[model samples]
Target: LSDPFVIIELLPRHIFSSCVEQQTVVHKRTLNPVFDECFEYSVTLEQCRAEGAMILFTVMDHDVLTFNDFAGEAYLSLNQIPGVDRGTSNADNFHGLKEIELNLMHQRDREHPILKTLESRLGDKAAQDFMKKCRERVTNF
Candidate 1:
């Protein structure tokens, strides 16, 4: 197994853009990694609803000489968060920890430019195979 890390981005969709972007520390050489990590983003509920924000989770393999490998990707919406409700779009409704499950596979419905770039860098076949392993290996977190 390779050392792995997670890159998380909270990007606002459409007119609204750029907000929270962060990454977790790399776990060294483990098939099963437990990351009891926490991250806070200062995004208002109003902004989230108006922009239709998406949380992008990119799992990558850490490498020294060569470029890191793209393991898998999962996407989440701010609206899907426990406290946030789309119907109300109330700022007061935002609070607390929500357990979000990432898809861990290529989402054909929407285009992911980052994934395409990573695949191009790693070669299409290599990226596809690695991502497949990531999907099989990682079910939930």
Candidate 2:
């Protein structure tokens, strides 16, 4: 088993590709990790809903010498998240939803750069199938 952490990438409208990024502390040697981390990005409501806005959650293994391993990832639309799509007010902020659980998954395409790398290291069939099941099971409300 390997230590794992989470990386959050936020791309707002007209912003550079690598604008805002955050990461959670590494959790050692566990498949299920619990993280109590917070991230804040200053973006207006209009920017949040813009077509260029994208939120990516990437799960990676913490490696010391070699490159980190990609476990899974999920693409989140800020518009789909509850309370985020609401009007510009305190109510829209993620206040009561302190323990929001988002399930991240591997990308579906075998040709995807991350997934390709993951498959090459972990073998193709089993890992890809597992990821497909995870994606189907996750329900965003």
Candidate 3:
């Protein structure tokens, strides 16, 4: 870690690791509330190693004793693939920005109450493609 303070500046959401001291070069990525909170993370460790981040620690998902506590062993698996932050969009509009939001939400909640309506409303396929990619990325991790 550059500085304990600098690590805070990183605001690591999709990740947490003891390897911060090993000089982690975090990838730029967005955050989503639902997936970020739900699953134990499996960010790619190989990418960070390729990017010059050496592992000093790790935390495995299954070893994560509680909802939050994970084995430090898995912390070495810190690299993340790009654009995998949120799996599927759950927004609500996309003929425009409004519709785009709806498109994302609909994908996120293909079965949500309000989102059923939003899915019915969107016309573009692009957002769905992106969301599909998101789902695949999430599955891979």
Give the 10-residue window scoring lowest on summed lDDT in candidate 3: 1-10
Q: Could you tell me every candidate's TM-score relative to the true structure?
A: 0.62, 0.63, 0.17
Runs in model 1 lying further than 4 Å from the true structure: 13-20, 86-98, 107-141
> Which segments of candidate 3 are over 4 A away from where they belong?
1-110, 113-122
Residue 135, candidate 1: C-alpha displacement in angstroms: 20
User: Which ranking of candidates, highest TM-score first?
Assistant: 2, 1, 3
Question: Which one is best on TM-score?
Answer: 2
Question: On residues 43-67, what C-alpha lDDT tens digit does candidate 2 reach at each position?
Answer: 6666776775668788889889976
Residue 74 displacement (Å), model 1: 0.2
> Residue 105 of model 3: what lDDT?
18
Candidates 1 and 2: which is better by TM-score?
A: 2
Tens-place lDDT digits, model 1, residues 1-141: 989999887754332345546899999989778777888777666766655567878888888997677787887876776546656444454365455656687444223575555546655665665456544534431
Cα lDDT tens digits for candidate 3, 1-141 = 111110111113223343223222222232321221112233353334344332223221221243322212222222332222133532232223221111121123335554344435457464454345334423321
Best-to-worst ranking by lDDT: 2, 1, 3
Candidate 1: lDDT of 13? 33
